[model samples]
Target: MSPSRVTYAPVGFGDYHWTVTDDDGRPWFATVSDLEHKEHCGQGAVAALKGLRQAMDTALTLRERDGLRFVVAPVAAADGGPVLPLDDRYALTVFPHVPGRAGEFGQRLSEAERDQVLDLLAELHGRTPPETTPPAAVEPPGLDGVLAALDESEGPWSGGPFAEPARKLLREHEATLRERLAAFETLVARVRGRGAPLVVTHGEPHPGNLILGDEGHLLVDWDTVGLALPERDLALLSDDPAALTRYTELTGRTPDPDALALYRLRWSLLDVAEFVEWFRGEHQRTEDTESAWKGFTDTLEHLATASG
Candidate 1:
């Protein structure tokens, strides 16, 4: 891997640090970065970089010994630190450069492609179950935590269409549905707390992680890895219901609505909190975190709408 020839893929800021090439052409990626939230996927995700690194390392070690598919191909550690495209107190891990393009991935695919993906999932799903040994428990943010995360000086959750809706929903449900929500919250926490047979995930198994290849859909983006909490991972698909059906069809099961709701709202708000933190630091503009704000609002609206 030569730095002179490497040009980063133009997705993230900081010089798109990676050389995208076929396996034959020479595949590699590397970078050094400071802990700046905005430069990463947004502020919300930035704070978790350290936790993400540990999770990835654990995942990689599991893969090496287990030989998983969804997990990428990483090398042994270098002298300085972990062998990866990054090592900035956050992470640095690379894979065998899975060949494929995002355009080719699909949840709503032709019969053949869908079947292929299901088969691949079945095979991958067989190797390891959700991880139980090292339980990476995700605690539901209590009122104090959620409010604290939302109370950043000028983060995304503020003064956006999202805030109005979220606040309105909270107000509306504060009294009528408080008990139900508390119960639901406990259920959501319990589900995640009850560890699963840990399997390798792309961390972020959204459509973005999908890569179309001869072998079928190869998952990418091992940023958020650990156990396969389908509720959490699957809720990432709330923005797309069709994908939910496809997932259900493939798994021969339907996801629990309450659990899905909790995961969606939790992550969506977490994104909001991150956006707020990022916006305060990066730009002093009103509309900087509009996307997250919009998502936050929409999540609230969707939940309110669902409740009605």
Candidate 2:
């Protein structure tokens, strides 16, 4: 498609987005993912791209082959691949701009919306995943940095404006963070020991990724897609006990509290680690960094609250 215009869509985190209009006035959502960020996939650059390609392909299979319509997979490029290498530092993928209202991150879904999502998730969990799909990640990316930050006896980090503040925050909450990490490790052991079956899971199935359109509730963001335990997806709904109970009724498998806690702790730890790395890297005072600073402090507090 020939792009007549391209405008940035300042929505969501972790991936750059743009709305491209074709010559025929058709709108398409363009996503440019940073190859260096290993948050979604478990590795950097090459391996991350490979994992993402496999994940996107699995998304396509779910929509086209398995007839799972809720999957908002990427549109294949000219090379017939879901991901197109933009440069060494980034990759580009285009998606059909689904007409609907998109949800925000951390927005609580209503009961009806929750039920609908659980139904979609149930259908997803029941399907057999593609062979190319990678295994779900239990370890959060950048965890080593979080641990290292806690070990540091220095005054502050030297990344940029947020660096010193982030170090201070980490220092203040070091004890709670360490305790939570230990609890997380224990929970991870329990979940792993259960020997439960893994399934294709949308790693971040929060409201921000959900699109309430005429077609129905469509889930965007496929980078974190992988084969994992049902709890990985169900854990996002831990805020609502009823949703967990309903999901158990639908899938006939009760969600384990330990697994749920593991994922919850995982999310907070991952966020803290990612923000720490960002602030420690060569960054500057920008809108994004400011946001990252807020996220950094917020996640630290969230972890502390959980520990409390």
TM-scores, in order shown?
0.62, 0.96
- The digit string of per-residue lDDT tens for model 2 on 1-308 reads 99999999988777899999999999999999888885577477888788888988999999999999999998999999999988877889899989999999989988788888988899999999988788877988788888887888266578787788778878899899889888888888898999989999998899989999997899999888898888788888664445677777788987777777788788888888788788878899988888888888888777777778
Stretch of 10 with least lDDT, candidate 1: 36-45
Model 1: lDDT of residue 54: 52
lDDT of 1: 0.49
Per-residue CA lDDT of model 1 for 104-197, tens digit only, reads 2124455555445544444454455433223333443334444453343233345434454454444544432344345456766666575444
- Report RMSD (Å) for each prediction in the order shown: 6.4, 1.3
Best by lDDT: 2
Candidate 1, residue 206: how far the Cα is off, in Å: 1.2
- Cα lDDT, all candidates: 0.49, 0.85
